[model samples]
Target chain A: MALRFALMIDPLAADQTAPDLATTFTAVDPAAPALTVGELSTQRGDGIFESIGVVGGHPQEVEAHLERLVHSARLCDLPEPNVAQWRAAVAIAASECGEGEGVVKLILSRGVEHGPTPTAWATAATAADFSLARTEGIRVVTLDRGYAIDAPARAPWLLLGAKTLSYAVNMAALREAHRRDADDAVFLSSDGFVLEAPTASLILQRGDTFITPAPNGAILHGTTQLSLFEHLAARGFETAYETIPVDELRRADAAWLVSSVRLAAPIRQLDGADLTVDAEFTASLNDYLLSPRD
Target chain B: MALRFALMIDPLAADQTAPDLATTFTAVDPAAPALTVGELSTQRGDGIFESIGVVGGHPQEVEAHLERLVHSARLCDLPEPNVAQWRAAVAIAASECGEGEGVVKLILSRGVEHGPTPTAWATAATAADFSLARTEGIRVVTLDRGYAIDAPARAPWLLLGAKTLSYAVNMAALREAHRRDADDAVFLSSDGFVLEAPTASLILQRGDTFITPAPNGAILHGTTQLSLFEHLAARGFETAYETIPVDELRRADAAWLVSSVRLAAPIRQLDGADLTVDAEFTASLNDYLLSPRD
Candidate 1:
């Protein structure tokens, strides 16, 4: 027998709307027949997923996000979800959702298949109350632990580049950060290089040049980060992608964690070090990020 | 409602009859109700699991296997399981199963909440007919992927040693290998050092010594490879845990991959070179590994 339960979406609809959260798609559509929750979990670690904010009811960076999804599928050898099917799912989900700047989480996972078979499944959902924009600056902690820098690279067998659902570790890291009474943990290499945060992109400023890790396999090829890179270049901000050691991070003029949801969050403190970087950096980036691109 | 499934026994029963798999603690009976699957998957990836061969109603490495299950839990920060409960589950599953040396996997993932909030959870189970072990050898394609070699040491904030259910990357790497028409892929660093095999232990033979990557946070601490090291040591063979560069691997006498299921599979060919190392080294290791430790 299939399991059934009421999805409490009513409470979420009654909220101030935020423009960043555009409804691109949703997995739990009202009109479509629902699937058993167990079935959803049993499908192999399905591929990876991303939660991007939509602007003006439009999925931000749709093409680039889809490209990453396709790349992740190829890397994991998962079957590519049909583009039309995905577009329809997103439309259906967006049509029924209520309220504000909600989240658009795109999950490209494995389809229902057992054994050594190629299966790729993609699902999108609009999450309520998952605003990346926060009122207060984040208290960040730095932790040392990793064999190598898990940055993104152009490698054929790179999983860090693909957003697969084996997110137990990622979620656990967040929980670990919470245990320490911090917002998030920064993953540093054994050699003490500032890598990406758990789910967000790393953006730091060295002089007038903004720097992020290169698109290596050690890190996820974030869509927002990529978008920001292009926008920064267009706005005449000096930008470069290079390896940044942990010590250099301490000397950074400013730092912020970027992601689709929390477009760019100011880094107030690093491991309790008082960061006196320009708070205006965040404001400027946010202004540009939220403004509609012609 | 709880999902009900029939339990079978035979090979599991045979292993249980030995009393070796029984918990040594007199205070707490080895056989007791443990934790649920969801808790284990969420918490510390703690659990005792075995992919064994059940030939003619007997399970392979029943004692050593069970002992390893306990060891894995301890190493990964998990609690001791009710061995009796595990044995009972295994026995029931084995009895009703078909004939032949099918795979039997026992997992002690998470356990019952021990009163106050525990730092970790525990669980265990067994399964038959796992496919990871049957392949003669894996054809590994290398990826210049940079993993934090000291990810654990650098990130005390992250649980590097835990074997949580977040195995998407590991599984994804296998799929990548399959896509490349290779059996498996060895994750490489930007510096060209062989970091690990997604699901198995890294083994490189230089002259007479068999060297594996150290048990750093970068890779899973493999139980089978550790057993082989002891076996190799007993025979005056030099087995060391050290960092191996990918360039050095290309010139090594041979290379092999070890895991719970694959045991020890020689790298017959890497890229395109035929190492032909399996005929002797893999067979010798297999012979020693398959032999009774006592």
Candidate 2:
């Protein structure tokens, strides 16, 4: 699927007297240019973003995504985003988009040089069919993230927790995975612990219980993983966030790379080591992820 | 100082049958937008850039900057930039820019998703006056870059040497320096070696000799510093690149952070420790840096 819809959100339109936020969430032609060349989003990647998975015209976990957006803004030292304003924009984008699986992205840039206000916008795109991976599973290779898990707390300037637009390293890791003939990658900390994947969270399972790398300052607190854990706990299964060692990955009975759009992809192989796959369980998790949660 | 000129360069226009590269670069309104929300440059900070210093209507070190741009593109797995087309665009930008001191920024983004061509542009802005820092000098602080020196060699995917647009961490480092009451920050390798500043290169002076962190696959080979070394060597000053230890910074007779637009700023203070400033020597070096150099 291609892009289903796009909207240019006016983050500073609250003071306007226009009803229905008529000026706040305006429609934008998705194909046209909508950003200045000077935007720090492009110049310095000085921004934060959020991508909410939308299914059947229902945007999932709007509150959680918005909360994470604010969390990211705080970590990046950006001005706090107005959650109410953004929630409204996501609604408009979801309703306008095709009623199939999709994603809604919100961006808050530091705006143009010397400009008074920050640049804000939201765009919606229909997600590509992830049917094959969701069922067939994906092979993953472990790459070194080169940072000790403790690096984040020692140097907040690294912006480790913030989901800023500085994703070149992440993108590079993905390319390396493809070059290695793997479908995805899992990053390992320099101190010999398992970190998250480039764009998703890493979870290892044994029997019925599941364990994911704890949300240390170095790893992103994955939204999808959090929701999945809740779902798992409700189903009477044990779930946990633990500091997983490199050798522990080999000991796992099963594993997965989970995210909002891709839902859950069972890790069939890890650095040449094989893991068991529960096709029925993985399918049920995908079903839970694709439904509107909030 | 304000933005003086902007040009959108078509990197794929070689097939056009036009003269003066007229169809290649078109002047853009500095105040208007020129990018789409879907562009990877803004979405993922997926691009490379070069900033050339312009003095008295001459773009200094154009070749070096462009060469570095190509180097960065290759490191980031981006398409090799068309240097000839970029040089022409830079010339046009410099000619239209104001005299005195300024900067011309060149950006080559991965472009909009699913688009055939890459998005490229150049913009000129009059530089902010650095009279105080150039003469009076600046205070410095050291921050951890969180990567071991050997890590870069081990993991090319980290893109340590690439001048990528994913600069959120650099921006955060600068902000951290400000909060610490310092004028700038130098990144220290996790293994106790000096790296470089957020946007400038670090050079330590002792007696009449100077040393900068070697371009050892972990640091950007600073273009301005390279030019200054050539100039200094001509003046009978010994210049070398070495793996300087952290303690070596405190033992230096003097030090400076050098870059294109900022030229050279002597270090007056480092982490609250004082250092001597050589006004006459610094000014002459700036004079050399300001002149058109290829």
Model 2 lDDT tens row, A1-294: 355567877776754334566567667777777777888999998899888888998998888888989999998888888777888889888876586788888899977888746788888888888988989999999999999988998998898888899898999999999999999999998888999999999888978888999887898888899899999999999998889998999889989899878889999988887788889999999999987798
Which candidate should be chosen as best, given DockQ against the real structure?
2
Residue A284, candidate 1: alpha-carbon lDDT: 76
Question: Model 1 compared with the native: what TM-score?
Answer: 0.66
- lDDT per residue (tens digit) for residues B1-294 in model 2: 467788998877753334567577889887786777888999899999999999988999999999999999999888788887888888888887776888899999887778745888999888999989999999999999999988999899999999999999999999999999999999999988999999999999988899999998899989999999999999999999999998999899999999999999999999999999989999999989977798
Output the number of the TM-score-best candidate. Answer: 2
Instruction: Determine the backbone clash count of candidate 1.
Output: 76
**Deviation of model 1 at A232, angstroms:** 6.7
* Residue-level lDDT for A278 in candidate 1: 65
CA-only RMSD, every prediction: 9.2, 1.7
Error of 2 at B109 (Å): 0.7
Candidate 2 displacement at residue A287 in angstroms: 1.0
TM of each candidate vs. truth = 0.66, 0.97
Fnat of each prediction, in sequence: 0.30, 0.71
